[model samples]
Target chain A: MNNSEISEQGKLTIVGTGPGTDQLLAPAAKQALLEADSVIGYKTYVDLIRHILPESCDIQAYGMRQEVERSRAAAALALEGKKVCIVSGGDAGVFSIAGPVLEVISEEDLEKLNLSIIPGITSALSSAALLGAPLIHDFAVISLSDLLTPTELIEKRLSLAAEGDFVVVLYNPASKKRTELIKKCAQIMIEAGRKDTPVGIVRHGFRADQNVTVTTVSEMLNHDIDMNTTVVIGNSRTYRKGRFMVTPRGYAL
Target chain B: MNNSEISEQGKLTIVGTGPGTDQLLAPAAKQALLEADSVIGYKTYVDLIRHILPESCDIQAYGMRQEVERSRAAAALALEGKKVCIVSGGDAGVFSIAGPVLEVISEEDLEKLNLSIIPGITSALSSAALLGAPLIHDFAVISLSDLLTPTELIEKRLSLAAEGDFVVVLYNPASKKRTELIKKCAQIMIEAGRKDTPVGIVRHGFRADQNVTVTTVSEMLNHDIDMNTTVVIGNSRTYRKGRFMVTPRGYAL
Candidate 1:
């Protein structure tokens, strides 16, 4: 059946593929992709899930930093009575496409589009799984990409997270042009008296090329990390146990 | 082949079942449960996945607050050459079983047993998806269950998170015994100038009886919330767009 004949309103599924791993992908997300008439996402994310797309499904791939455009295009397609899926690497609700999609669609359009967000294993949780449990206690997640947010605001959040003794998860820590933000973040944590806190750097988490490195806040700069890495700085009670980096849950036992 | 004949070292898999929904369960977690010789978890979580367990697998169920005992029993079973799976609701790494499992096992035991953690959709992400993208910006996750964490510490973290303008996700917000904690949390947020901030309360998140309510910080206490609910309080820029609660990602556009 064609789009118009099948239903009056086409559905829009925002799918989070979960750290680019098939095993980590929720069953609902996989089912949504299979049922989608078209899949739209960043080129890199599209490549990650290319194998799973149905042969008849249309593919619309964009380059990085085209999130807004991609979301709008997906919404437009959905409004045209086509079942569309906008893909994100981790949980779509976490610094991903879900926000932008919601932002662009008006209230009337949203009601007509039949939108649903399928959650996935975010990088923070996936990285924590690989590095023991650094998120066992209260934690904060901050993105260091100053292109959208001001550097001063990022710095302020970092200092407050450190001061609050949160196990801070740093996303988009460093890119080609933003190479020094991670260092500044580490400096803020060091100044907040977490100089010796345990930190785990996980690159390409849950992928074949995954790399896990354990270091201290003061020594974080010595590692080779980039935008692909998720850096987890431990709280005051975080420690090293054998090869694992662990932050104890606040339990009396 | 029997466990001893197949391999000398038994396997232990810590699985996150993801908000009590089978569709939300990761494929890896489902596979791990099916392949296990025995499955162990809190009674509630074990019940959540009982239908998916293999017929041959033994099930060990424990009462609430038996996390340490459950992990120890699971570890001991693994040491005896049984493939064991310990389950947790939501992501095991986030305020869940991964920490206790790692803490209970010794270095030698860890090396002797094959251990793996399969990530799942955490309540924070699932709740965020259901409430729209309140987590698109920097966020903090704090558990208000002061049973383990002192009330003073939770208060301090709440104050700092508010001061930093971080989107906050509150887990274990209220229970029958802890009826007043959630009220105190709202008061702190209000005092920090977030009196009108958007708050989303998600109960039974992905389950059949799931409930979602959107309210302001000042009116949060008027809603029906319990420990099963995950509360998300928006930052300064959070707003109600239609039925969805959204927090902007700070894009320049």
Candidate 2:
């Protein structure tokens, strides 16, 4: 269906905001937000795009861990004949709100509601662009958040990605309760013969307060990483040239 | 450096055109392309955005396998005091032209040239949006192209991703000479105990002729897949609820 063809009835639109920067937001997402009768999202995410939203749009902001409630509210609003938009900070498909929104919708509601997902540039893509092409080859994106996933599973995935020599993008690498996961991730890569492999750590990538640093698996522990940081651990072929971290696309050069 | 601060000197800008759809392209990328003195990209990619480009902008289209030459030509034009925009079909950082552009830039040229990468929605994200929220958890993106990477290495990575229960997004799964690799990947996943996992195959995801299919790992080999298809193999938790393929975010609901 044409994304521009808005239905006469109320609909539920899922918008990927693309790394919290206005310039980074896709035209499709921007259009969805502009046309939304109501916008439901995390408090921080809503604030990121608050200025661009129309005054007629009803804004509901929820604190952290209220994802289910927010999605339910959005769906309920749509059921009431309102054009509702559920916004995600990154691509809704990747570790974002799309799953929760889908989970809250019932089978009976599916036929009545017009649901559309507007794609956005994920945080991995945003951070990778800033670090110059560290993800030019095969890669794995694993979040270190133990709140939802078990730490054992996270460690297992890290080891496997390192062993397979896939470039790895680690999200939520550290938090108040999970400071050691990044260190553990680095140790796994080091043990897998990637001690000297380049690692690009980007904080608030593409934003005004963005910070980027290039380090190695062995020295990653020395850097200051937190939940806001997006870490890219390069494969064996990834290297640092000047300030940029690059992984070749494996052309026969 | 602020991305908005454009220097008076000619510069090289790498633009991600976002899955060959105008609505999917980021505002930053569109702005860069509109202001460019010339645009260089693959013939197919150039044709995708021909109508939107400015009349004064010189367009150079190259055939396949000329990525190196295209990047070089764009860089040379930028060095000759022309604003050059090198376009890639999807996100320039993912299996696209960003790496080659970075590779050909010399140290001396770096000081004089302004290089910026405008991120776009990759095909994986586009396909995931079309299929539903199949990538809400940790995932791995592996290109099955054996042209640059060894088939043995691709097989190893596929096995590791399956063993770790990571959702996998396979790019370039099949071509004229690479028909058997997708089948081999399915075998590895089945051997790793994901025989009943859900699989989503999306072709030309966000384009006019987009097609999305949701099936099980056992039934995947029965579908018609090719280089144009982006295959998503779900983890153990992934399931099909009606037409949508969803992987839960593991919330304690």
Task: List candidate 1 stretches off by more than 4 Å.
Answer: A1-6, B1-6
Whole-structure CA lDDT of model 1: 0.91
- Report the TM-score of candidate 1, chain B only: 0.96
- The sequence of per-residue lDDT tens digits that candidate 2 reaches over residues A64-181 is 9988888889999998889999998989879989999888889789778889999888889999999998989999999999888988999999999989999999998998778888
The i-RMS of every model, in angstroms, reads: 1.1, 1.1
For residues B1-253, what per-residue lDDT tens digits would candidate 1 score against the true structure?
Answer: 5876668667899999998988889889999999899999988899999999979999999999988898899999999988999999999999989998998889888888789888888899999999988999999999999888889989899999999999999999999889877888898999999999999999998899999999999999999888789999999999999889999986644
lDDT at B165 for candidate 2?
Answer: 91
Taking the true A–B contacts (Cα pairs closer than 8 Å), what share appears in each candidate? 0.83, 0.84
Q: What lDDT score goes with residue A152 in model 2?
A: 95
Our tally of clashes for model 1 stands at 0
TM-score between model 1 and native: 0.97
Give a tens-digit lDDT track for model 2, residues B129-170. 988899999999999998888889999999899999999999
Evaluated on CA atoms against the true complex, candidate 2 attains a DockQ of 0.79
TM-score of each: 0.97, 0.96
